[model samples]
Target: MVNPVRKDGTLDPALSIKNRFIDISPPKVVGLSNGVKAIEWKDGKVIMLDQSRLPLEVKYIECTDYHIIAEGIKKLWIRGAPAIGIAAAMGIALGAQDITAKNYREFIKGIETIFDVMLSTRPTAVNIKWAVERIKRLLKERRGESVNRLKELLIEEAKKIHEEDIEVNKAIGRWGSQFIKDGDTVLTHCNAGCLATGGYGTATAPIFVAIEQGKKIQVIADETRPV
Candidate 1:
């Protein structure tokens, strides 16, 4: 569960869902008792679970440099629309922390460059573009602020994005569960579960919630073939 919002409206880094929800007791899935968090920040670096090795080995890759995050996204190390968006936002935050510019102008230019690289990683997910643009807008709004303050704000914004995603997923689950009747069978394709999104999932969230609500819903997932 996400912590209550702070008085300042910005999410508390200590209370952020990424810290409270992702690694700590994760939702259970058959065969994989341990839960997986696609992206997270720890020890002053961005840590991402290597999705390419799923169901075989759970490997985590630590990224201190933002460029590596771009490569990770392009190579599908982290997938799903919402997850991609969160990764992009966090990548921008990480990139901002590494800027050694002497002035705000140079810092803004450096951030813009990082934005472009992150946005170019995946074309199919509009969420990625949306998340990057959100940070870009924040940069524009705080242009007059000091570089260090702006970096802190960007990190906070990324955490906000992450926390909001978890809430959104839960709300999706709650609302969608209403439409599912007891004993209903659901058919799905590809991976849409806690592993795909911040938590819960877009398509599978309802199923999980329905079961929790005592609805005997059956789910069948298709084995998606790559094109």
Candidate 2:
């Protein structure tokens, strides 16, 4: 049976506690509890949870084409600061996967086009620019490498961005949890939690961390309403 994927694409803690893994070919990024990831890069391609189908069906989107990633961002199939940023980085990597460039100069030229296109998908998100520029900088520093090596480096770097986001969010969770003590009730605005972040989320990170820390905390999201 398909488990319901939350707005954050996390699995039901009750059902997914025993298993969570990724399938490379068909590209399934199923989650375990809070371990869910909204987007992932695999086999030089992008795999994402179809968030638009939430509360009804759980589906995944495997994009071998970078343009599809861009379209996902534009259409909110992938929404969230860190997530969209991760998507851009992965999309750039996927876009570069098929480039038949013979030399560094030609390869970089194509990367520049991809970099801009990914950024345009979500111009306001700082993370998108942060991620794209990081990739751009990686290329600039690795100009001495061959095109094939550069392509590989881009994929690895994109994965690094994805990993880094999880860590960063965890760090935030640890630090923020301090403010949330046992029996505290926290009120937050829209998309401040896992709903719009890489993993643990921004504002919601503390609550999850607090709970893990053995705190009894209640949360009220100002933006959430019954359908």
Candidate 3:
């Protein structure tokens, strides 16, 4: 004879909630949901999801042309300043993938369309415009080079843009941790770190660094809401 619900004699529901609601038992650091997927590059196509509708409806759209990707960036389906810059670079790469231009003028025209579209994605982020403009300049300056080589360069540069974000986060953490003592409370406003950037996060980096250093800290996550 045993009581089913009181097997452990405790009223806490943490066990039941974790077992029922969570997909992974112990949780994985790089779960499928958060991990990066391999970029599927067809002969001439851009297949990607509009991330703005995410945490709501998981929708993936194919960009037959560069215009769609530009709109996705501007509309914020794919945001975050650094992320947007990376996306813009990708957009240029995608735009150039199928180019069969016969002369320098025609080639420059195609890339320029993409450049203008990408710059319009988000007006506020200086980095976004800067990235697109840099690519545009590279293409313009090297008009005599092979178009295929230029596209390869674009892809490599885009990867760098995304990779640097990780370094940025780690550096922020190292520098900011010096301010925190052994035991202190931290208050974070909005999601300014990992989610906002790429990996390490911006405002949230120091807190993580302090925690790793064995500093005692309490985090007050501000719930942004209209009062």
Candidate 4:
């Protein structure tokens, strides 16, 4: 879930939780479920689960303003590599929707400003840079388009990024699941579970797939200590 971090870089306990469940369910490509969606677009806003409150309270933060989205990413409200990218894309779209420029040049400048803000949110996640660049490229290609149309296109692109990430996760799960035998045990490190990706996850997807395929494989996750 996405819980806003305080000025001191700590999550506000009022907006976070203490205990959370370990969900290893296979990623759902369609429809909604109990599994946390790292990021989502709904009714002209970006909605994210308050991951800071996971395993206990399921809270969500909605962002109609791109600045809020940027803060969310900076504060680790919505994390995971792919998920961060998705959030950046959506944040760009949200920012685009509010552009009041009367000409293409002004609109492009506004978009660039938004891009710089999002890019500065985090320095480590390459996916965020990749997603932002994709959005920038798309915007450049549609430079002559009207601001309204460009906004629509940006929103669509953001949603596309979110959808493609889930598909990629599923593909990873499918390919990785093949290595598992009926009773093979799996081990994972860190938080590479569903909470750490757009869906499924890089490291935990196979285990979920195996369980879904009726395999009795077991999973042990190492909680990378010393936080």
Candidate 5:
């Protein structure tokens, strides 16, 4: 479950940990999770939408190597802070699986390179660092497990991170809608919408939630064109 945004606009992380599960059924609670997932972990790889193909074609890049994911992040193929974070976690999982390690000690040593690659991709994007730290903590806590078990656990943890991202995005939409009035026009800059997040959006979440609440709202985004 996503913790409700506090009054001061910071997340109360404790609220999310109280429960083990939360329902995010689509088109029922909100239209936020209706369709389209920008990133996912599937078939033992990280599958991410190729954002550079926008307005021309829809394509997904299946990355088995952390290097591929790192390039995607650096090139903005997997754009958005939240999306980048998810990519980082999945990239770490992908990297972990290929580690030529025979034991926990060797496995831990191998992930240093993976974390370095991911962290170097986007220094400004704090979520990327945050995501890497999560994997680091997991590795530290589970350092005693067998190599195969640790690999499986890393994959599982990465998937959990993906799921949690969507949940938080939904929560953002729900909470932000309260500020959106009927017939309001929301102006935004850059890409903080569906393509930039796990789902719903960061800046666009309120608009979506408002529309679903039967409040007609307009959205004008300052869509940037690369020079």
Candidate 6:
């Protein structure tokens, strides 16, 4: 979740925790998740299309609710591994925003419910479950604090996970792109490109950026099987 916009239209600190670990410049917008808003991208941008709809509608739906986000994950709106993890984190944050409890015990129970709700969104994606559990662990440790405070912290932590992924991709691109020289014919499986991740696509991100930097590489897109 991108930091919730404050009254002044500035991103709140709680939303900016992800900025600490990475440099992300992709253009995005807000969508409603369960009545609470969450960050999503706009159309005609680097990572705008609902990738699963690729070569088809090119349509991108802004996910505002946890339910929608979860469905997106299951349906492959964002199919890549890193992208799924980021989406899962955002889903947890969206679910956690509605938790209301005055006492520690009740608050903990509230979070447990929220966690279960978010986790139920998808089952096959290990990264999705991992990210949700990560947030749940943090929420458990922060049970002593006010519920509102814990919500903010959990959302921020989730954002951090989303942001860190972009940096990780960049590093991988820098190192991996070097393996392919100009004019090399490379065969790739599946659709892994800019539209699949935050910064760049994994496995093929380095190849895309390398091409942009004037490094010549011929890519063979395989449509028959998984990469």
Question: What is the per-residue lDDT of model 1 for residues 1-227, given as tens digits with 9 covering 90 to 100?
Answer: 45568888887888754444321112444211245588877767889988888767889999999988899899989888888898898899999998988888999888888988987899778998999889878888988999999999988998899878878877888999899898677776787776677756777777777767777655656554432
Candidate 6: tens digits of C-alpha lDDT, residues 103-144: 778877766665566567666667777887788688678778
lDDT of candidate model 4 versus the reference: 0.79
Location of the lowest summed lDDT over 10 successive residues in candidate 3: 22-31
Positional deviation of residue 70's Cα in model 3 after best superposition, in angstroms? 2.1
Regions of candidate 6 where Cα sits further than 4 Å from its true position: 1-49, 224-227
- Give the range where candidate 1 is weakest over 10 consecutive residues by summed lDDT: 23-32
Best by TM-score: 4
Q: How many residue-pair clashes does candidate 3 contain?
A: 4
What lDDT score goes with residue 17 in model 3? 30
Assess the local accuracy of residue 50 in candidate 5 as a C-alpha lDDT between 0 and 100. 83
* TM-score of every candidate: 0.81, 0.81, 0.69, 0.82, 0.81, 0.70
Better structure of 1 and 6 per TM-score = 1
Which model, 2 or 4, shows the larger lDDT? Answer: 4
Tell me model 5's lDDT, rounded to 2 decimals.
0.79
The lDDT values for all models are 0.79, 0.76, 0.64, 0.79, 0.79, 0.61
In model 4, what is the error at residue 23, expressed in angstroms?
12
Per-structure clash totals for the candidates: 0, 0, 4, 10, 0, 7
Summing lDDT over every window of 10 consecutive residues in candidate 2, give the lowest-scoring window: 23-32
What's the C-alpha lDDT at position 62 in model 2?
93
- Local error of candidate 4 at residue 102 (angstroms): 1.7
Error of 3 at 165 (Å): 2.4
For 38-115, candidate 4 gives per-residue lDDT tens digits of 778999888887676665687899898999888988887777888889999999999888889998898988888998
Tens digits of per-residue lDDT, candidate 2, 1-227, equal 66657778887776563333221111121211445657877666688877777648667899999999999998888787888888898999999988889898899888888888888888898989999888888988999999989988989998898888778888888999998877777777766555355666776777677776777666655565422
